[model samples]
Target: MCMPMTGARRSTSFLLALTTAAGASLLTGCGVLPGITGGSREPLTVMTWAPDGTQATNMPGMPATAVAFSRWVNDNGGIDGHRLKVLTCNEQNTNIGAGNCARRAVKEGAVAVVGSYSQFGSAFMPPLEAAGIPFIGGYGISGEEFTSTDSYPVNGGQAALLAGNGRQLARDCERVALVRPDTIDGDDLPPLINSGLTEGSRHEVADIRAADDAGDYSSVAAQALERAGAGPGVPARIGRSAARQQARKGCVTAVLGERTETFLDSFRRVETADQKVRISSVVGSVGQALIDSTGGKEGPFEGAYVTGWYPESGDPRWDAMRRVVDKYAFGDNRIDTDDAGVQTTWIAYTVLKQAVESLDKDSVSTRELAGRLDHGQPVTTGGLTPALRWDFASMLASADFPRVVNRSVTYQVVRQGRLVAQRKGFVNVGPTLENARTSG
Candidate 1:
């Protein structure tokens, strides 16, 4: 005597998947360069990623921020009387591009490098380390890069974020599924995934490669649903599958997606092809392009749950950040495009700035910077809660293996195909890291 499953039921299951999976991410914007009123001959340079060359053209905000940051340092009598010279590179999808950018930063005598962008963060690391330059920003928290003394990661470690996500899921859902890239930027999640689950929570995983060449989520969805006891199309099953699929794929579902719209197109086909299988995800799953391209039309992604990181700045934080962005960066109209990126970048810059200013001249060396970071300082940019600290060494202090704490966890849902904040509070689970290994 089970009731019929509907899209609503499916949606819930999908959200459970996203929230239950590992990791947290906060987007931040570019930092402003200081305006030096009068300065010494020495110039301090900062480098960042301008992949689309939009900083030069479309998004003038990024460069403006860089300029303002430089100008601020100069106006503040310059960093120890050294004028700042900011350099930005459009490191499009090529390592060579990133390498070139890094080389430029090094050649220009950059005391510290910031904002190299994603995987490029590591790409720039070796050079900065070799040059004995202190690097502070550029997101993505890979464990390998975290080991470097020359680099200070403002962003939380990926291992901790994922482990936190897993722990949260273990508490929230009986059956949880993981859908993520096969080649993650940092640490592999197999161990983190294992650590997050409780004794009896069911687990399923989908290894989506970088190219996303495969146009299917059915096998993954089917596997997860089967394990979740949703294979029979009962009311619970329908909801479970829908929710699980949505969580893992976002709006893409089990369908393939060459582009965001392609996901919607394929999603419709999948659902139409089979009405019983529900597919859902967090709101941000469906790309903004799809949302706009479809002119806000309802599609498979209409009611997915989007769980992502956000600062605790409240509404006022966003406003203050916006002013910082608008005043400093140019053509930042798309600030709304990726709020998390903006916030993260800002946080990273502010942390580095504070750290740099706070350093006693003797502690300017790379080793000193790394040492000082151990005290676990709290950072609050734009009033975001969840104070971040550095403890990778301690987290890895175990005799046999590394142990980590899932410091904080948060959740957001996709309403009207947009990612919106849900209840955001960290669960203080003693989540620990297990089985660490270098990826081949």
Candidate 2:
């Protein structure tokens, strides 16, 4: 009810307001500031990053799944009533884009980067490492995920998938061809698949490298068919049916992430009934969802072999996650429950929640979370993964991928358009990897 005296009072008032607002902003950008902190009786913040809407490989489902998990947890009392704040970034599948996302996570005060995807580990790992931020449940796309001290991978990453695929293929195929990306990460794949092949006394894989983002893989498909089907060591072709061909003709397995479908399309076009070879891929590159979209029983993937880090999407272990998605992330089309990325994100978040819950407090530091996980904490993911424990003693005996703890992979095959288990339960490929490391 007092009248302004004009200039001096108004100017002073404005300056004071500006000062207060600036202070608030400073707090907002901190990794843990005031109410929104990794402290007791407070909210926790984390990030999930992945490439989306890119020309090359993309996993829109990973970040989308993280968003869904945040929505679900926050709605359901939020990890012991401390709300979960998830910040998602699109890495755009570039080195700079990955670095930028990591920097953003650091600036925005994320306690951890959880259940994310990026093949460019060399780009993103540095920022998080410098900030001492933990990376939990990454999609395991890069070698750095296995080597970096900050990374706590939920699965054996591509190493397990390829090695498992090798073991799976070796059991049946007369010859093996691996079509992988020509990137640095792709270089590591051949040795892994070979390790599994060695276990079954099969010959080394015919390593074929291709562009990850190619629009046309017809030539590559032709090459794969020739190398795998007519490679030097293969027996003279005598079979026609897929089942018969796999054991006599050969097997061609591609691990080209999102571009796998394109490769298969090319493979299908060049392939005739008499020239058919057994098709195969790891779970992240292929799943039931892809099988359905391609033509089910009549598709190229109808008789393909696929190796996975977890049970197939239809397993009852995923019921709880499905329930959460149906309740909170309803109609979010980006989330395909069958997607390996979506499943990884769900499990990664589950690990994070369990680590946080173990603290039994609202406040958590990056050290606290990492410490709890590193110190032999066993997280049960409702059977989504073999109860994961990342203690040093539990890790595998490989110098290349020493941090690997859960080295189990499921061997699956497409039957009647569905990716069902080829063999019952999880297959332990630790010895295969260990052998590969020794031979390398």
Candidate 3:
């Protein structure tokens, strides 16, 4: 018979049992159990989060695209025969909500968080970093997206687009009016646009601030048009001839996020036929979806100049993505092929898949996945971006955004209700951003 344990022995045994149970519980909470889940042949879990049904901004398509991508990949034998499991969360466009989503990703043991949209990067990135999870292809709304170590953004984000737009418009417009939100984020826009204009030997833009959630923008539009020197009473059929009349034409570029459509609605109502102001915006603020929702050919965006991070939706490079949507996401109205958010999600998953394939392993953890990416391997997005490598050499010299690897933007024009390439190649804005950083 075993002798009865004494006081110290019994306490030590009880403490050991308590610690063991706690360790198991912790692993379970993190969604990592060797044989039970995340096994060699089990599914690889990831997450995508975006704001939905919000008062200010919404990006339901990001998560919707992630779900569709999981289905498409699973049908195709998944990433090296391992099914991809995607968890989605609605950030609700708030700081607390963004934090909650990041926490959920950690608790659910997401290997990576891919192709999500949120302005509250400050709230979300810390949790993701603490959990050692990589953040891939975040819609570049917040400054934190560029600064965070874990973030791997696919596009040059708004920085490249605004600077590129300034370069494009500088070639034509005599005066440029910049209409942006009256927030902290808006403070950075003027300098960026100015950097490009300064590079092009053009005058700086007339800065106009507007409320982000304002229902009426007629006054703001009127102010922008006036500042742009878009005097009323020009003929409606100005045509390309307006391009030649450089002295009379001024460009109005709006960087407001979702409220851009509302602002345009008010702008059209106040804008006269004579005003030859060329309306301009980045892709996220104005795209094919908005053009279709507003009248197509007769929409406010017609003849507008737009800047984007990728090739047009009809580009042959997107053939594979289109095929996936056609086969897997049929009748899924939420997944718009042209929406930049949806496109970003596709490209992000492509990066994730490549990383997983490179691993060539049966089981993967968040640490291992992030390690592979941080090792400086370049990811090719089939011409969507230059082979993306986040090594020190790939990073820009900008003091504010050292991790901006892709500095290319495409210039597009709205014609016949479609966004077509105005210039048939990518324009590198790395130099402009560098200039801005040094000057700032």
Candidate 4:
């Protein structure tokens, strides 16, 4: 007793089938919803925010990477069968904007805020702390991230980099000069850099401050070169003549964030063949993309010294992260695997995943997740970062950064326009930090 097949009925049936498949894909692709078959009753919600489309210091990739991580993990049955949701916000590089993002997380019942970036930690950290939510793996831009009890930083913040950079430059350059932004946050940079320089028995760094966002850095560049003991009139090597006595090898390190490139451009223009001063910066200021853009082997960054939290972009340890980006975030230009923000986001999510998986319950609350992290669960980042655990003993003894658990940095140098490993492995800057704490 089958009805005769009609063209109209066939079209309707096909449409219904397509709709069903689309619904299933949406549920399983990025996140499974509560009450969906095989989904846990309690869903996990998290937020990731960064300045986007702002005048200065934007990190849109941090949030974008969060989205991609959600999609990839959900596709593979989600994190421990619990539905995972990511809420992203734009901080707009303002205090009010950062506060707004933090308030939104509180309103939305986010269990955690992971891998975010903001210089206004004063505005943001309060809300997360009040709500008893943990902040994990922030981009290390704000000082409150280190002092807040609820924060679990994966890497030592900017303090570690300046110190590490000083240490790296100390080996070869007898005189080192630092050019950094002129801002409230920038005030702390000089002391940290000096700590490392003095640790290596080198003279303290000459602090040179400049506008954070300037169209020209000619004056600044000239001043830096002059102070670093690099000049066109002096010979590259020490000579017997009194005039050549000023030829002491020098280096200038800049930490102007995005404007580092602009400063370097001006520095190159002012540079003379007789000047053998080396250029230096930390990872966030210089990376593979910048080097490639400047023309590989012929780039201005060639022979420049760089320090970073992770390995060089070409290292084999990053193979697993590369595969994830390829499988999930392919062609998504916002999520650059080489980007430090994106890499931090990936590692932050890995910690969250491990935290959730460790609990044996079908439903989880923010307190439960935070408690798991608080009890010192070791998180493995596939060798991206050192094994991370946050116990009382693990906290750094430093006054400003007591919550920092990982104080290691890698030394890298630009060779033929590519960032290569300058040191074999992570350089332990813990002693320098402790020394700085005691001395300061």
- Against the true structure, candidate 4 has what lDDT? 0.81
Candidate 3 residues lying further than 4 Å off, grouped into runs, are 1-39, 236-248, 437-440
TM-score for each predicted model, relative to the true structure: 0.65, 0.87, 0.87, 0.87
Per-residue lDDT of 144 in model 3 = 79
Between candidates 3 and 4, the one scoring higher on lDDT is 3
Alpha-carbon lDDT, every model: 0.46, 0.83, 0.83, 0.81
Point out where model 1 deviates above 4 Å.
1-42, 53-83, 120-122, 141-143, 157-161, 168-177, 182-187, 206-265, 273-303, 312-315, 360-382, 388-406, 416-418, 427-440
- Cα shift from native, residue 276, model 4 (Å): 2.9
How far does residue 342 in candidate 2 sit from its true spot (Å)?
A: 0.3
In model 4, the clashing pairs are none
lDDT tens readout by residue for model 1, 1-440 = 22333598756644553465331111001122233221123454666554554211122233345555665556565665445567766665455766777778788766666643544555666777787776664443344445565655544345444454555445444454444444445236545544655432465333333223335545544443443333223344455335444343112222112232434454344443222333323212333444455544244444443333443333455665566555655654545424334455565566656665555352254455555555646544544535544566444443222322223444544455554555655444333444333351
Q: How many residue pairs clash in all the candidates, one count each?
A: 56, 4, 2, 0
Residue pairs in candidate 2 whose N, alpha carbon or C atoms collide under 3 angstroms: 31-109, 38-364, 39-363, 40-363
* Ten-residue region with minimum lDDT total, candidate 1: 23-32
lDDT score, residue 335, model 3? 84
Q: What is the alpha-carbon lDDT for the whole of candidate 2?
A: 0.83
